[model samples]
Target chain A: MSKRKLTIAVTGLNNTDNPGPGIPVIRGLRDSEEFEVRIIGLAYENLEPGIYMHDIVDKTYQIPYPSAGTEVLLARLEYINSIEKIDVLIPNFDAELNTFMRSADKLKKMGIRTFLPTLEQYEERHKSVLPEYGEKYDVRVPKSKAIFNASDIYSLNDDFTYPVMVKGKFYDAFIAYNTEQVKMHFNKISSKWGLPVIIQEFVKGVEVNVVALGDGKGNVVGAVPMRKQFITDKGKAWAGITLKDDKMLEQTQKIFSATKWRGGMELELIKTNDGKYYLIEINPRLPAWVYLAVGAGQNLPEALVKLALGEDVKPYENYQVGKLFIRYSYDLICDIAEFEQLSTFGEL
Target chain B: MNINRNIAISDTGFVFDPSSGDSYSLNPVGTEIIQLLKKQKTIEEIQVEIVSKYEVDDVQLEKDIIDFILTLEQYNLIENNE
Candidate 1:
């Protein structure tokens, strides 16, 4: 009788509020009865060592996260192999997407479901990559250039505008208000982070992000266009309002199709001073504001779980567009502390 | 660290003072830093003090204290005594 029910492994279960932006996915998975869920983590801070959260999980297992090269992901794969079976591998962090993307072929061979966007798709949505694609779509993106070296940056004079963005290939991003500032930032980051820096034109406007879940069959099932009011410590949008506009929703679909992307995606759109919508970057996974998507009406996690199990994907009723969500709780108090990481006594 | 006596709290995290139309989040660190700020420690003073006392680095400590106070000022947590 139990053989038919799916056993999904919810990895990175950090039993804390600072669990990046992935906590809501766990909550949504737990709320659904379709999947028999078990939580796997590196440690259980919520309980005594070797003891897991009995209330939230059917069973919990401890696997040490590896610090060495490929050890962490390998440890995760080994844990996956130990499981009865896996239906899906949901990456909870944008940083994890890189590793998860590389592991896609292996997971597919193992008969597990992993929804990773393609390299082209990733390039289509990345902040540095958006401007190039924006040209074809007639979508205005920040004036940008991908530099191969530090000298390429130093060669720039007053020809470039003030207040440009210094974007990293990975996580770290910064703003440079002048040539000296840009060079100073470049000097610091180029040595520390390695090469291929992106210098982008800065646009001043309201920052809006679009969250959408898509199936592999070229179908986008759930979506929300939102104006982010604040971002929490883990880069999660702490508070935002969903936009109620069919035009924005339609345009979002246009951008996805233009990119020929699959899986879940979020696009950061900057409305310029000229009333033009410029696609700044695309996050090929859930945004920090996904919980707000649930509040707005579409439960993307539930939809994603169903799709991963090889079940017939269902249509998602469009969620209310103008709903607002603000993350505030006893847990946030803890999350913000660890996140701010300010130099202060009693503030770590 | 002593907090300014007049800081008012709101349920939605909307902190304010009627004297000026300023707002802020006692966003955990903000809560802790405000306690320190009321002691009237300068930014560098707080950074040096925190690094010596806490389990953080010089760079991180400076960034955190400066950002925390800046956020405080943004939300009007630090007001004009004038």
Candidate 2:
């Protein structure tokens, strides 16, 4: 008997970050000859579809923005349902999480598996709750508070120092210094996003991103650490390298156990001069750049797919460490632009 | 914070930290900050130059410059200049 075709749909594939990490995860599944993959997003047309080498996607789907609570989402979801046997649904962008999470019941009724942490887990892992968890892992997460009204944020503890950052309950951040300054920023951001707002400690250090794969049984199957070699204007890490930091790995495992995390995740860590790495936030989905974990030899989406279908998951073994992958242009241009000071940024 | 170190970078934007065997790459502003620091510009001085070059504000620039210079120093990218 021929192998049954397993279909997966990835939302938010249109991000312009070059050599997108998602490609590798898709490739791992397609190349394994076990699954059929389809990438769903408006990426190549609406966004800069920078050169990519992953040829696994059987088809790419594009949908318009303002998707949630609107025709776009319904249309897209309808299109998705039209396609049979979409066993796994991976929501890639943070912005899309709200729609899918809010609409979870409906999707689950359709027999689609959501690749998110539980709702309760999401609440805890969000900006408001992660800091407390950060303390457990010795990760320096930004200090913040959750606010219902923008006015309440104004009269915060006057003892609060300068340079605090105000952010959404999720990923977006708006940096503010003084109270009055934050008030002005408050209006600007209020018009853009709805609260509860998170006020966090503005911790600074070299950003180190850790991507790990978790078996559905709550064990960290694989993990990789990469320092922020370069970041885009939108806070995307443009250029980075895979590292072999056992210390970071241990702390990551500690946090994973503490959170009872049971899926693929990305942790943003900051390294202080005192040789401490502080946790910033935890991402519950396979990040766009998840392929780095693949480059490092832990293919998450496939592992999760296998685990979800009740198949025996192969244990992840240690692989060659210290492998580096760079974007075709961003890392290169950023390097040429700053070559004069290469002595400092160049040291690795 | 002064970028009191000679930096070598790859065309692919790989920042090799010879001091700690660690490497970093810079975004556009990160690249600018490292350059101005290499010219021995003070944090405040570099902030002014950077603001004229990017959309970031003085408050952010101030904190970013100080924190970034410290980050460079922490990674042994540089320390106090003579």
Candidate 1 — which pairs collide? A342-B64, A343-B61, B23-B75
Tens-digit per-residue lDDT, B31-71, candidate 1: 55555566676667767666676688888878777676565
Give the range where candidate 1 chain A is weakest over 10 consecutive residues by summed lDDT: A339-348
Superposed on the true chain A, the predicted chain A of model 1 yields a TM-score of: 0.79
lDDT of 1 by residue, A162-210 (tens): 7787876655567888677877777776775556677888788767778
Which parts of model 2 have CA positions greater than 4 angstroms off?
A1-4, A17-24, A31-56, A60-79, A98-111, A132-142, A152-157, A328-348, B1-82
Whose TM-score is greatest here?
Answer: 2
Q: Estimate the TM-score of every prediction.
A: 0.66, 0.67
Query: What lDDT does each candidate get?
Result: 0.62, 0.63
After aligning candidate 1 to the native by TM-score, how far in Å is the CA of A333 from where it should be? 13
Interface RMSD of 2: 4.8
How much does each candidate deviate from the true structure in C-alpha RMSD? Answer: 15.8, 14.5
The number of clashing residue pairs in each candidate reads: 3, 30
lDDT of 1 at A310: 64
Which window of 10 residues has the lowest lDDT sum in candidate 2 chain A? A339-348
